[model samples]
Target: MPKTEKSSMSWLLRVIPWNTTVVLFALAVTAVLLLGVHYYMEGLISIGTLFLIYQYTQMLNDPIEMLGDQVQEFQKAKSGMLRSRELLSMRSEIEEGKEEQLPQGPLGLEFSQVHFSYNPDKPVLQDINFTIKPGERLGIIGRTGSGKSSLSRVLLRLYNLDRGTIRVGGTDITELSLQALYRRVGMVTQDVQLFDGTLRDNLTLFNSDVSDHMIKETTDRLGLSQWIDSQPQGLDTYLAAGGASLSAGEAQLFALTRVFLTEPSLVILDEPSSRLDAATEGMLQSAIDQLMKQSTGVIIAHRLATLEKVDRIMVLGDGKVLEFGAREELASNPASHYARLLITGREEELA
Candidate 1:
């Protein structure tokens, strides 16, 4: 079920004896000994003959079974090996994960006429333009494939833009150290990736220096304290692999806690509460409120209620900024592409 144990089994299967070979060899030797004794009494055979036959049988079967074991191991190892390799080689988010040594960022992001495509001759994002001031709170919303997540990637330097310049703290991202750039940024995707470790370890990521005070403060404010309080080990509670051990809402809330602890200058959060129940969504809202307070954030939100508090909403379509301004202004106008779309999505929610 887990990678380590599965791989270990593969190695064992590859090395363990074929067993059939051992059983057959024992039977052959026993038969030879019996026949040899019979021949000795009848004066028809020598001990040398029996020894040679048994030794030759062993020499031929041992190598064959050893090869069979190796093949068995190979077969068992195949699927898991492929999965790990594919994950390692798959296209990375926006840009590759390189190390950066810089201090603070979100610095300032501007997209001046950028275009992108997942495949050649077919583009997903067309000309786009927007400037997010350092510490500016912005929300991006669009229908699926409208390029919301892609927009986050561009800002986070997951992938570089084809056209336009993306500057961080007054320097073009191309010129900044990737690791330094990322160190100052944190993100919580709709997909939360938690490790197989203690709750504290998952939260602090082994940082060790993140004070328990901060962890407690975040969970308390977000109503996570209730669950944590119930745990026998408190922060030391173990988080099962893939977070299967956690409820969907708790996992999402935990992800927020992790981002809050990181204190990145720029934080990007995809809507983890998009599918949550109202009560759970409310908890998520409180967590998000604390996260966004006095900090820079880029939110890719679907629910209009979720975007209501943002400083501004950037409406994206076909990979470009179709509308940008105060949420109130966008909502008041019934004719704008964003307004119409937002209205449509809301109606669907109500329906």
Candidate 2:
């Protein structure tokens, strides 16, 4: 027999012996006998005796049922404990450091000889190197699985680098505290998660430092104030689970509002307009343009049009940089991959 079949047979055999079917059959037989004795042969056994037998059988079955439930709960807890142990045993990726601060204004970023892999044997990013000047806007584009997202993850220090260093504001990112790193770098994604609270709570993220004036200012900038005003209670309006009440574009705008309030030195936007309709995408584009004006920005976009306003573009292919330079320079080169992408994008639009 095949190993899988043998394992299945073994599991069946183990389970068959401990099943409740046999006990239930025995109980049924016992109840029938007691019923017959009490009703037909009334002198030999009384109804009270029959009732006592039923009660005793029920008492015997109750603990078994309870035990089955307890066993299931125990299994669940055991699985949780194993996962917790695994997490606790793993060490943090961020190195110990006292540097808990970054530059006060827009910060530049540099990646030097960086390489990383989810599995050490299969590298996801290969010898990546790049630099973004403070307040510069760079757009990243690549085919799927091109390591575009991995670059952002490495900059955010979500995973430990297998080789090389990343510098933010002239200080090695790994040498900075995780909190400091995150506080200076912000990210916005297409799928925005809304908490179960009023609109104000979702916008401010329960941060007391965020003032109503700031919220109003940012919302106005993002063109979200009109939507807020349309609400019956404005900021006090309650959003159901995952903000089911708001449209997708509104939720995304709310996420941008959160990022704006933070005033981070750098921002990463991962296809923020990819899933939106034409009108919503236009709104997202405007908001993104405003965001880029305030901070150094890296935009990972599939659509070439979104890169029009960026200062530079980085094209990746198979986890490697195919081209990196000024958008205008890359666009003028018909032989370049970015030029091909733009031509293809334009062709698709016309088609």
Candidate 3:
């Protein structure tokens, strides 16, 4: 049976004993009342008085039954509270050190002999080693579970590596404060999260210091100025939860705009165009191109069209690198995994 069904059954079994106890206790109380009536007032009590006594006893029993139910609900609530407490009490995986410092300016990244896993026995990234030049735009491609997303997580210091080191701007990431690392790296994922606020609030994430001119300039550069102007409220327009007023593509574009305002040295796009239609993908592509021009980009994409302008491509399989080189060079070799992917894409396009 499913685990949920089994758990429900177990809970029912626990409550059964308590319910049975309450039922037996109520019956015992009723029997005692009858015995008292028989001994003390066998001939004196009227039929009406006996009926009233029985009715009062039943009224008392009803509250006892309700108490048992309340106890069961309390038990469930306590269990949930304890689980939440356990999660809240755990320490963060990323640690801050007193002596570690971060470097400034555009940052290049290097992953050397990196290995990590959510589980100790099952590694997610194995012996990964690669370097990205300052301001280089890299395209990463692989099948599902090939560790494409994991790379971005590691760069942001979201998870510590079980082995090896990651360097940003020539300084080891582990040696830098978690705050410093995050300030330098940004990521845009497939799922776009928008808060319930105005467009400008979402873009600046409620930071009061970002000037209107800066926000407008970045939006214009990303080709979103035209759309923003068409909106009735423009930047002041209110957004519902998850940006309900906007389409998925519009939400993602808004998310991109938010990240652009930060001006991070490294940007990771984890399949930013996957959910978008062709027209939206084109818009996303154009926005991404502009964003990448000023920062080092690490794009994790499935579509070859998205990788056309990338400086290099890294293809992974089963947590290992299959090929890593210039996009043109990798696509030229028929035996290369990237070349095979391109051929497959072309065939699918024709069909």
Candidate 4:
């Protein structure tokens, strides 16, 4: 069947009523008008037909509503399962650092001939191709919903692109195990998600095998040591649900420490400070700068100033790579939409 036809039928099946009140009302009205119509034509009308139709409708509506309720309950159950699963999940369970594939080798990354869309014909990233050398810090700036998140997903292979190839460290990501992929990459989002556990648990992600000294060093460098000290049990104090026990900056500090403990080869941060105040953002930025000192990284930010000192900037618009080059070159060329927008976003920041 055609898509529209199927959709309409499904809607009608879902929406039509089955109750006898409507059927009886129709029957009564028809009866009242029967004499005029019967005398005008050969008589062929009955209340039984309406009654039978109403009975069938009742049968259909009962199971339809019941099935709908079941579907909703099933979704709620799935959501609950995931919530509990994350509570049990470990954010990090291993130690830091990986040696370069070769001595001073390029931790190169590439995306070739990629295409993606949430739905067909509405592609988000089109024929994308780019390469970033090892230890290169690239700033990715795009208008809201300009496929920035999709690009990240493609890099992580969250969903397969319609067509493309992606390589990390000279090996096709398709050929690499997800475990290795994650070990090679780390990320922090706008919101820091802390489990209901101790400060050390959140920092080391409950890895009993990891040394306390390593956790302490990572936390101390990220300035989480003071927060830990403030707690009654020091590193052993329970982190309330979502880290509610700690202030926003303190929670972010813990998150940075967690990432630092792993010290993945490539770090991706997506608006990690978008939700924080000036002081917390400054603290987080400082920690992040320290963390990125020797790693390949991608920072996706809305404000150009957040990425001012990064090696290169790629600006995207309407799912296409609009302008990409050195930040200085982009800053010099105001004719580009990206430069214009950066100039505008900066002005607003100042205002």
In terms of lDDT, which candidate is strongest? 3
**Candidate with the greatest TM-score versus the true structure:** 3
In order, the Cα lDDT scores of the candidates are 0.74, 0.79, 0.81, 0.70
Structural similarity to truth (TM-score) of each candidate: 0.72, 0.76, 0.79, 0.65
lDDT of 3 by residue, 63-130 (tens): 77777777777767866776689789999867864434555656788999999898998999999999
Worst 10 residues of 4 by lDDT: 94-103
Model 3 residue 74 lDDT score: 79
Error of 4 at 73 (Å): 17
Residue by residue across 1-351, what tens digits does model 2's lDDT show? 776885566556545544654467577758766675757475766777766766776666666766655665665566567668978999976674569988889999898998889897888888888999999999887777778788888888888899999999999987898889888898876567788888888888888788889889987887768868888899999987666787777777777778888888899987743455777668777888887787999988856657888998988777788789998899999987778877777522211
lDDT by residue for model 4 (166-185), tens: 77887777677677777777
Q: What lDDT does candidate 1 reach at residue 224?
A: 78
Clashing pairs in 4: 107-134
* Model 1 agreement with the true structure over 93-205: per-residue lDDT tens digits: 45443335443544556677778776768777888777778877788876677887777777677766767776655666666667766667778887788898899999999
TM-score of 2: 0.76
Ranking by TM-score: 3, 2, 1, 4
Candidate 3 residue pairs in backbone clash:
none
TM-score of 3: 0.79
Give the Å error, residue 26, model 4.
39
- Cα error, residue 187 of model 2, in Å, equals 0.7
